[model samples]
Target: MLSAVAGAVRFVMVAIMTVVTFITPFLGKKEGKIERKAEECKAAFAAISDTHLTDSFIRLGMFEFGLQDMAEATDRLDALVINGDITDHGYPEHWQAFTDTLLKYDISDNNIMVLGNHDTWGGDRTGDYTKENFIKYSKEATGREIDNVYFTAEINGYPVIVLGSQSDHTGPTFYQDQLDWFAEEMEKASEKGLPIFVFCHQPFNGTHGLPYNWEMEKDADPTEGGIGEHSDYILNICNQYKNVIFISGHVHAGLSNTEDGTNYSSVEKVGNVTSVNLPSYEYFDVLRHGHMVNGTGFVFEVYDGEILLRARNFATGTWLENYDVTIEIEK
Candidate 1:
């Protein structure tokens, strides 16, 4: 009888916790403030990812509309970065749809995109998910020749490094050559005494409170998700830098905290690197606030001493108040 009662108590506790997790977002709302300390000492940008654009006309239409709203909202954005997963499937049609939507909005020139696992058919889907096609469609949509998926560019005079995986799509993998390139880039930025913004499609594994399934199945390879074979190498390289803002996506988790009160879905810091996981612009098994309000993205405003990340739903013109985060920029 004692053992049975103990088991029953445990079950009840789990059930109660689950209920609380689902309702917490409604109980308290968090808001972020944007205070400009200096006019010349700051820049602003916007980011959203995991669009998973499909070939459906309805879906494409919705995305098109959302793009319009996003553009209108961030009219003064210094840069607009679309992190990855531009298409749901590695299909030519899906890519075309995504391109069409961006072109229609006249926001193509403002975007800097990367490739996600979905674009490479890293999941169960199969197709000609080649780098050639990725660049081809990307250029068609943006009207810029992208010879390399990974490159560095200056955003408001800041050295920003963009990274893409050439292997192991779902989880992330950086070949030795890629790692070498990253190290060189970081060295260059460090030598200049400049803060760097690193953008990738996958978040770092294990550090953000993401579950094991995020990287791989429980029984599958232990090294997947954000913690792939080259995670340590990449992270170690990043840690060597002083101020590195690494942003990623792919996990379509919601913008709310999980049942354990962990908001691994948003901003987190490990070592000298601050990692940001942008919430999906589409719908998925959202752990926060049930589902996203569509057209969800973040606006980053940099000040003299800190950065403010404010989450907003362009489709609805409202902010996810509780999801705001402020990171102090290290001197």
Candidate 2:
């Protein structure tokens, strides 16, 4: 009877943790423990992920606070990089909705976007859209022609590479062509003796804190998460480089909890590469504990020796307070 009772208690705890993980974002409680800095720095850029813009004006309002904060923080914003998922669905109308809203805030020509799976593939989990369509709507919205899905842009004299899958689907597919292109870009950046800043919609395989890490086992399906088939090839390229800061999103993981064993901080440094996973800017269930609230992203301030990632909720115009993290840049 005692053994059975203990087992039942264990089951109940697991159930509670699961519920908390999903529902914590809706809890609406402020994170009070972390310190908030009012000062703004130079040579900083803001990055966000998983906008998942739909036709709802109510959902669109979430961007107001973040935009306002950026305007107030910096007059000449170096670049505002939207990691991916600009549209909830791969519909022209949905993409237009995102473009319309961003225009209201005047999200500048410096805005850099990396295509998310949902942006290329329809939200119905159907592979209905094409890469051409994504580029079309993107060009129409940004007024800039995207020659390739994966390309590099210079921000503050630093080379930042934006990577996306060539195929239009809601999964990470690194074709040999794309891999070759990446290697070529990395070589060029390496020749300049500059640290490469790479942004992709999907996180690399085996990255902790990302949702992909859970299913990256020996036989797990590739579409579920992570790089999947060419995981080794991708990582090999990253490892070959001396300084590669790879940023990604797609997990929609929350940023509040970093204590529990399974709950990891958004930042993880492996070898020469440091991977930072941005939490969802939309409503999605998170890992371990706490769901992420809307308008959650970091204002990355890169200094000579260190980079500070300041977490904030643009919706609320408040800093995550406790989640400000610092990473060293090898000089």
**Model 2 TM:** 0.80
For each candidate in turn, the TM-score is: 0.79, 0.80
* Residue 131 in candidate 1, Cα distance off native in Å: 1.1
Error of 2 at 309 (Å): 1.0
Candidate 1 accuracy as lDDT = 0.68
Kindly list the per-residue Cα lDDT of model 2 for residues 95-200, writing each as its tens digit.
Answer: 7787777766654457787888778766444323446666676677666577767778877767788888766555666677788888888888877666678998
Model 2, residue 126: distance off in Å is 9.9
| Candidate 2: RMSD to truth | 6.3
The residue ranges of model 1 lying beyond 4 angstroms of the native Cα positions read 1-41, 122-129, 213-222, 257-260, 263-265, 287-292
Residue-level lDDT tens digits of model 1 in 99-164:
877877654245777778778773434323456677788678766576766777767777888888
What range of 10 consecutive residues in model 1 has the weakest lDDT sum? 28-37
